[model samples]
Target: MPSWDNTPSGTMTAAALSLPGAQPPSKCFTIENYYPKPTLPSQKWVLIKVKAAGLNRAELRGRNGDQPAPPEFGMFVDEFHPDPPKVLGEEFVGIVEEAGSETKFGKGDMCTGFIYGGGKAFDGAYAEYVICPAQRCFRLPETSLSWDVLGAITMSMWTAYGSLFEAAQLAKGATALIHGATSSVGVWAVLLARDHGCTVIATTRKKDKVAKLKSIGADHVVLEDELKEQLKRLAPKGVDCLLELAGPDTIQTLALPNLAKYGSVVVTGVLTKQWSMKDFTPALIPPTRKMTFYSLEPGQEDIEGVESVIADVISRVESGTFRSEMFLDKTFPLERIGEAHGYMEENKAIGKVVVTVP
Candidate 1:
């Protein structure tokens, strides 16, 4: 009576792309009926009706062949299955349409989460339906946080959380230097760090965004070129931590000089889109300093920690103190995914770009 093929009439649509190749966004990304709605893979997974998904720089780099396939490539729904034309979205907000036995969530429960392998190892939230581990997903409260805001938070907020707390050990009264202050993660880091009682020194290349960054809890905003000089005036004792979201060039030129003895530096992103750092060596850092690279790619063992942080972030977002909406620069219909990717690739977007599924 419950036939698999009898479930739905239409196929799920996604912005599909090829891998290990470079092409314009228009040519690389195409909207098509990419996948049929996926079935529950196990008692630990759930099928979601995706509402919105955020486009990230990782997906862009993967599409443009700027980065190679992750080692986990070809694994779909936790299996070593080779499925391609991959659907490209990593972070999303959706409603649980079907749930397995082990999940606390039931059918129709609204949810949001980010997964490292989504859009890579399997079909991602760019589709109308996506299947992911229920443990990797979190149920959301019926609150004022909209779908777009929830989607945007999945990647940027998680990175900010891990960078500030786990990687840098940022504590109240610490001083943080946030490179690339205009980025979505940079903006969130400034807010999150300030809320945690740290004095934030934010940096930006655009003079126009100085006031904007300062308004979001940055105690001091410095131009990227003037980072070293301004930092000396602002924090003569030196920065206790630096969230290096910029490229290696900034880390070499601006960040190292301002680091305090015993300070920590967390490298999380490459806004410069350069993966390799030329003329850089570990010896360049002071022996007293600590360096950590924060990545959201966690194994099964780290799920509880990820869940705990997501819960805390949701509580903060619902409290109205987090202001998640401020970081959304633009949103597009699913069909306009190309334009969205183009906007980010061109470095025109000031914050997160989201794709809204109808």
Candidate 2:
């Protein structure tokens, strides 16, 4: 067990939200001292000294007070209530400062993973130290990647993996359409699809990102308006898989119509901030096609499977199959977290936005 006596300070700095969804990003957070440094909550939880933390759209939704409610029937019931003043980063890469008696990790082991209600349910990675359940943490492999790059990957990459392989059942030769291609998860989805031997068609609202998406291994990059026409020419048989990140705004009109006879659509992230379709019905879905939602809520039965996906991601990065550098869009010091949130809210970033903790 690590001794708290040797620790430098009992207080840590963090960006906290006292009132969510009431103010702009610039005015939403308050950086101040958080006292009595967080301790291990259980024998299965580890304390992490955060090196770098990644931002997610979920945090934005939390800050804006517009997050979708958890599914009523799953393990997520009552699992997502975020009580502020709270810390809000969902993913991070860091060094283990203290390990639980039952954990496989030890002090100084580099680690990264997701925290379910990070910022809302508890203090998150925005601080110098954060607590994570041992089962949710992944021991990172030896690599040359910087902390910021690794920090930007965890949650987004995991979501992409779950959506493509687990939820959508993407095949090696499938044609994958990644809507909202410039978002962090969208970028990873594109790369993962290409690496898995699929032809990737990525879509973005802006014309400038077309080249960036294509350069990242997308076989075809089309504007949202041009997707219908481009798909007719690129894949007349229709796409085999669709990773819908844009949510209700485009899923019905743009996504479902472009699917192959037996294609699957995985609705993962709601980037548009719209929760439900007005007057939705099962009849809207085409016959023989399927749609599902994907989420990585804590305490799910399949939580153990995260370790394998993390290992696969790190292995690909180490073997040079996945380009880790292309995923980082910007980095901010922990003090500039408000700016980071603002950047993501404005859609100014192409990939992941991370915060480096000193």
Candidate 3:
């Protein structure tokens, strides 16, 4: 096995965006010493032997330094300890190696969750073993679903659930227009919207994915160029909610003033890789309609809320109401995580690229 340290027996290998001497974005990631099953600091934390870790676009953004810590968050800097270089993955499916005394989980249980720090605040799930708060870890059913599929569920489904139900106030019989309909969040939004008895109008730049979108319960699928006409024809009453996954271009062109009175638009994913909107003003929105930019920052919400979201999403996935395998594009072994990152950078992956940690 390739390693950065001579003591491979004592530590597990992890793919890090930038180790002590490594720079990011354009540079290759390095595998370095990652301690598996570290000392338990408190009775609320649990150690996990990572089986699979899912790659997300946010990790790329973190690699490029696109996200920065908020100023107020600096107040807690005193609580942080000097640790090894940060690892860069968020979602994972793993086996519980050690459950804390107070945790309800047990050893040998199959579990899944998002690392609270995740490449920013602390070292994350790009390693063979990860430690997370027990409340954040949810139990998984004994099913034939691949680890990659379960890994893909956490971030995407949680983001979709937050955006649709929490932010947009989506309801049964509502009309939802999802921009970037082929994205992971968009795909989940479509499925969830359909499951809730909503009329889903989905959009994608790829014409070939139209039928696939319809098969997943989209009431109407339209090319990006034909969005306006199709929305007018199918939903006549402006959509009740708009899922802005494509970012600025879609928000500027499709969101503002394009809703029923009291309708909302939740901006979530930026699949367009574009963040800013030019010449934008709140005046563009019609009276009574709202536009919200939703964000699920780590540690931003209470532990109970995060745990609830994870539990609900996991239950939905197991019940067959939400198909977890639909967004999986491919998997790579831990040593080839660079290839996985490269695949995602190329925009060739239709779904998620995961890394299998053995």
Question: Per-residue lDDT of 200-316 in model 1, one digit per residue for the tens?
Answer: 999888888888787778999999778777877898978999999875566766667778988988888776766566788999887788877786543533766766676777778
lDDT of 3: 0.72
Regions of candidate 1 where Cα sits further than 4 Å from its true position: 1-10, 18-24, 69-85, 248-252, 276-282, 297-312, 315-319
TM-score of each model, paired residue for residue:
0.84, 0.88, 0.79
Worst 10 residues of 2 by lDDT: 1-10
Error of 1 at 12 (Å): 1.2
Q: Can you write out model 3's per-residue Cα lDDT over 1-358, one digit (the tens) per residue? A: 2111112234777776663323433365777765543445567777788899988776765665554333211222333333333677767899998888999889999888665354445557889877777656777767666787777776677778788988998989999998877776787788888888999998888777887788778998999888888777887768899999877666767787478778998888666666667888877778899888776544554556656666666677677766655666688888887777767776665556788898
Order of models, best lDDT first: 2, 1, 3
For residue 285, give model 3's deviation from the true position in Å: 3.7
User: For model 3, where is the 10-residue window of minimal lDDT?
Assistant: 1-10
Per-candidate alpha-carbon RMSD to the true structure: 4.5, 4.2, 5.6
Question: lDDT of model 2 at residue 250?
Answer: 71
State model 2's lDDT. Answer: 0.80
Tens digits of lDDT, candidate 2, 1-358: 2211123347888877766776567577777776447888776888999999989887887788764455411232455453432777767899999998999989999899677555555667888888887766888867677888788777788889899998899999999999888999999999889989999999999988888898889998989888889889998988899999988667788678888999988888777777678777889999989888887655553755776677677777767777766688999998888889899888888889999998
Can you tell me which runs of candidate 3 are displaced by over 4 Å?
1-9, 18-27, 33-38, 64-85, 101-103, 248-252, 272-284, 295-325
Q: How many backbone clashes does candidate 1 have?
A: 0
Best by TM-score: 2
